[model samples]
Target: MNDWISHFTSLTAAPDNEKALFNKARPVQWGSDQIIFHAGTPCNQYLLVLEGQIRVQQISAGGREIVLYRIGPGESCILTTACLFSHRPYPAMGITETAVKAISLPKSVFDQLIGQSGLFREFVFNAYGNRLTDLLTLVEEVVFTRLDIRLARKLLDLGKHAQIIQITHQTLATELGSAREVISRALKEFALRGWIRRGSGQIEIIQRQGLQQLANSEFVSSR
Candidate 1:
C-alpha cells in the first residue's frame, strides 16, 4: 500500500481496508507549472495529492483565465471526481503550481472502489461537496461583489503575512478574473490614495488600514 496513510491523514479508512485502494493507486509526479490536464480532455485516472499544489482554472471564451480552486496536500480534485462520476471530459485545465506528487487510481479501479468501499465513497463525496461550495462562493463573489472591493480584499489577504506582495498586475487580474488594464488602473487609484506603492512586478502595502476600509466599503468601482 506504500504507506499512503502517512500523507493523507484525513482519509480515515482502517489500514487493512485502505490497503486495497493504496495498492491500486500508483504514484505520479509533475514538475512545477506543468499542465496535467487540458480542457475537454477525458480523464482516465483519479488523483489524490500527497504533496505540493495543483491549480484548477478555467479560461473564458475571450481567453481570460480565472482560478477555480487549488488542491493541496491531502486534498483531491473535485473536477476529477465530477469527470469520473459523470463520465465527461474536463471542463477546465489543471496545472501544477509546485512540483507535485500524487497517487493515481485508474478509472476502472476508481469506479470499483466507489461501489465496493464505503470509506472511499465518503472520501470522494466529501471532497466533492466542499469544492462545490467553494465554486458557489466564487460565483456569488463575482456576481454580487464589486471588483475594487474584491481587489482590496485580495491584497489584504495576500499581504496578511508580509507587507510586500510579490506579484504583477496581470497576475492579479488573472486571480480576480479581470483584465490586466483594469487591474492596473485600480492599482493606480490605490496608489494615488496612498494605500499602496507599485514597484517592478510587486506592490508594497503602505496602508493596510486604508485597504481594510475599502475592502469593507460598498461603493462599487467602475470596471
Candidate 2:
C-alpha cells in the first residue's frame, strides 16, 4: 500500500480509496524484451508501472519501427487508457525494456475510481494530456525536422551515461524512424569528421560539443 501510495499522487490523496485499489489490482512481472502488448491486441487492463521501463513503439507494414514513448516507474500509459475507453485494439506495441514490476487494474475497478475519486480523475486526465502532447511533438519532428539532427540528438541522449553506446545501426534507425542505409551514411559522415568512433554494434562519442552543435542547428544539410 505504501509503495502504491508513493508512486501515485492520486492514491496518496485518497488514503481510503487506496485499499480498494490495492484489493482490485493484481501485481504482474515481465522479463526484459518481453512483449507486454502487441499492435491490434485488445486492451483489457490498465497498467501502473512500479519499476523498470516499458517502451511503446509502432511498426509499419514495411517492417520499419519507430518508438512513440516510454512508461517508467510511477507512470501510466495514455494509449492503454484511451483504448480501454474507446473499446479499440491497440495501434502500437508495448514491450518491457528491462525486468518490470507493475500493477494491472481491471476495467471495473478503474471506472469505479474514475467516478469516485477527484484526485484519480485529475491524474488520469493530466497523464493523458501530457502523453498526447509528447506524441504530437514526435509527429511534428518526424514530418518537419531533419533525420540527421534527430539521430544526433538521440546519440547524445544515449551517450550521457557513458562515452560508448552499445547499440546497432538498425536499432538507431528504428529509434529515429529512418532506414539502416540512412543511419549508416550519417554515422559514416560523423566518423569522417572525427565526431565518433563506430564499431560492431557500438559507437563511442569522441566530440560531445560537435554532436551538440549538430543537434542544435540545421547547419548539417540533411543527406
Candidate 3:
C-alpha cells in the first residue's frame, strides 16, 4: 500500500493524505483494440492507466476518428474527471492499443477524495491544466503552423516510442485535421528528404534528429 501510494504521490505532491481514500480501487483489464468506453456513454467510473496505451478519440462530423491524445501508463483518463462533476455521457471514446491494466474508482469516491484532500485536488487541477495547455498548443499549431511543419513535428513526437511507427494516411489526416491527400503529400515530401521511409501502412523514421530539427527551425530561427 505504501508503494502504491508513493507511486501516485510522486506524480503530484501529496501522498500520505490521499492514500486512505484509494483503498477501494478496483482493477479493470482491456484487450487490444477494445473500447474501454464509448462516447456518450454514461460516466460512473474513472480509470487510471497502470499499463499499456489508451487513446482518446472523437469522430468528427465527416466520420473521422480524430485522436485527441494518447495516454500511456501513469496517466488517468480525462473521462474520469468529466464523470466526477457531471452526469452527462463521456465526450470521447477510450480505445486500448495494447492489453491494458487500470484502476477504476466510482465517480463519487473520486470526487470525495479530491474534495477532502488538498494534495489530491492539486494533482487533478494540474492534470486538467496540462490537458488544456496541450489542447491550446494543438489549436495554435493548426492555426499558425504550416501543414508540413506540423506533420514533421507529429512524426518526431510519435517516433519517440514507436519502433516502426505505423499509421495509415487516413489516420494521419484525421490527427492533423487535414485531408488524406494532404497528409500523403506531406509524407511524400519527408520521404524525398530521406527523413522517413514510407510503406503501405507505415512510415519508418529514418532520420529522427533531422525531422526534429526541421520541426524546431522556426523556434531556432527566432532565437
**Overall lDDT per candidate, in order of appearance:** 0.89, 0.88, 0.77
lDDT (10s digit) by residue, model 2, range 1-223 = 4456578766676766546675788889999999989988999888999999999999999999999999999899998999988999999999999999998889888888788877878888999999999999999888877887888899999999999999999999888888899999999999998999999999999999999998998553343
RMSD (CA, angstroms), candidate 1: 1.7
- Sliding window of 10 residues with minimal summed lDDT for model 1: 9-18
TM, every model: 0.94, 0.93, 0.80
- Expressed as tens digits, the lDDT of each residue in 30-98 for candidate 3 is 899998777778888867777899988887777666677777877776555866677788888888989
Residue 26, candidate 1: alpha-carbon lDDT: 89
Mark the regions of model 3 whose C-alpha exceeds 4 Å error after superposition. Answer: 1-3, 10-20, 160-165, 192-196, 204-214, 217-223
For every model in order, what is the number of clashing pairs?
A: 0, 0, 0
Model 3 TM = 0.80
Q: Candidate 3: global Cα-lDDT?
A: 0.77
Model 1 Cα shift for residue 30 (angstroms):
0.8
Model 1 clashing residue pairs (backbone): none
Residue pairs in clash, model 3:
none
Tens-digit per-residue lDDT, 119-164, candidate 1: 7788889989999999998987887789889999999999999999
Superposition error at 209 for model 3 (Å): 7.8
Indicate which candidate wins on lDDT: 1
